[model samples]
Target: MTIKAGDALPQTTFMIPGDSGPEPRTAEALFKGRTVALFSVPGAFTPTCSARHLPGFIEQAGALKAAGVDLIACTAVNDAFVMGAWSRAAGAEGITMLADGNGDFVRALGLEMDGSKFGLGMRGKRFSMLVEDGVVKILNVEEPGAFEVSSADYLLGQL
Candidate 1:
């Protein structure tokens, strides 16, 4: 089912590009006892994702932290290497990059989208949420081909 307010996030593993290499991080490890501002993009380095979606979070990360968020995280269906590269290329210092390389996390939340029309395969939908202690407090899922409610500004406003 699509994860909603009050729903506990599903158990899944995400890859993070560690100092040595890709490291596995469990959902519980990331969310437990933390107020996380989590956002997902269709893929890393895509037009809108690179230009706006990710940058918006990177730009407003401090404001989010000031608003009581403990962590700012970004996720995508891309692998850890891509996520790491994107983080570096965008200078996303404060954001945690969570790599759902196989779309397992998004699929568990019923948020996967078909991107085959653009030569891309299945991918995660563009969305953002406030997760507190592993439960969802707020969710903003963008409509197909739209980038409205899922922006960092919108989430900050909600906070």
Candidate 2:
């Protein structure tokens, strides 16, 4: 089922590029007692993802914190290495880059998209959510080929 307001996030393991290598992190731990703004994309380094989605969140990250967001993160179906490279390439310092390499999180949320036609396999749909204490407070899922509702500006407006 698509996640909605008031639902606790599914317990799933996600990864980030750690100093030594990829490190595991869980949703429950990530959202415990904090407000998180997490946005997901189909893949890292894609055109819109690199130029628009990622940059928007990075640019607005401080403003989001000022608005009470404890953490801002971006997720993709790629691996931790790629996520780290993309973050470095984009200069996305404050935003955490999460790797859902196996698509477990997106599959659990029923937001996986088949991108085989583009030579990309299963991927997460573009979406963003306000998660507080592991429960969703708001969600903005983008329509196919759309970037409207899930953008940082839109989420800021909601906040």
Candidate 3:
């Protein structure tokens, strides 16, 4: 089942790459005390994700923060190296790129999507959530091939 509003985020560790090296950060640690706007993409550098999903969040990071969000993040079912490279290429300075390597975090939240037919293996569906202090406040999950709700503009209106 998809996670719903009011559910506490799953406790899962993400393999995130920092300037130093790969580091582990738990879901609780990332959202426990912050009002966060987090969006997940199927894969980094994919057409829709690169052209729209991530760039929207990066462009609106300042507005999101101005609306009281503490942090804005982009999560992908990819390794830290790929995520790091994508972040740099996308000019995502205000957004933190999180690597859900091994899909542990995505599976824990019941958001994993099978994409083997597309040669992508398992990946995350396009979605965004507003989380405050460890509890989900709003969740916008996009239907396959659709892009109406999960965009940053929609989330900004929700806030």
RMSD of each: 0.5, 0.7, 0.8
lDDT of 2 by residue, 28-141 (tens): 878899999999999999999988999999889889999999999999999999999998899998988889999999998888999999999899999999999999999999
Off by over 4 Å in 3: none
Task: Write down the worst ten-residue block by lDDT for model 2.
Answer: 1-10
Lowest-sum lDDT 10-residue window in model 3 = 14-23
Top-TM-score structure, candidate number: 1
How many clashes does each candidate structure show, in the order listed? 0, 0, 0
Error of 1 at 17 (Å): 1.1
Off by over 4 Å in 2: none
Q: What is the C-alpha lDDT of each candidate?
A: 0.96, 0.93, 0.90
The 10-residue segment with the lowest total lDDT in model 1: 16-25
Better candidate number, 1 or 3, judged by TM-score? 1
Candidate 1 per-residue lDDT, tens place, 53-153, comes to 99999899989999999999999999999999999999997999999999999999999999999988999999999999999999999999999899999
- Tell how far residue 146 is off in model 2, in angstroms: 0.7
TM-score of 3: 0.97
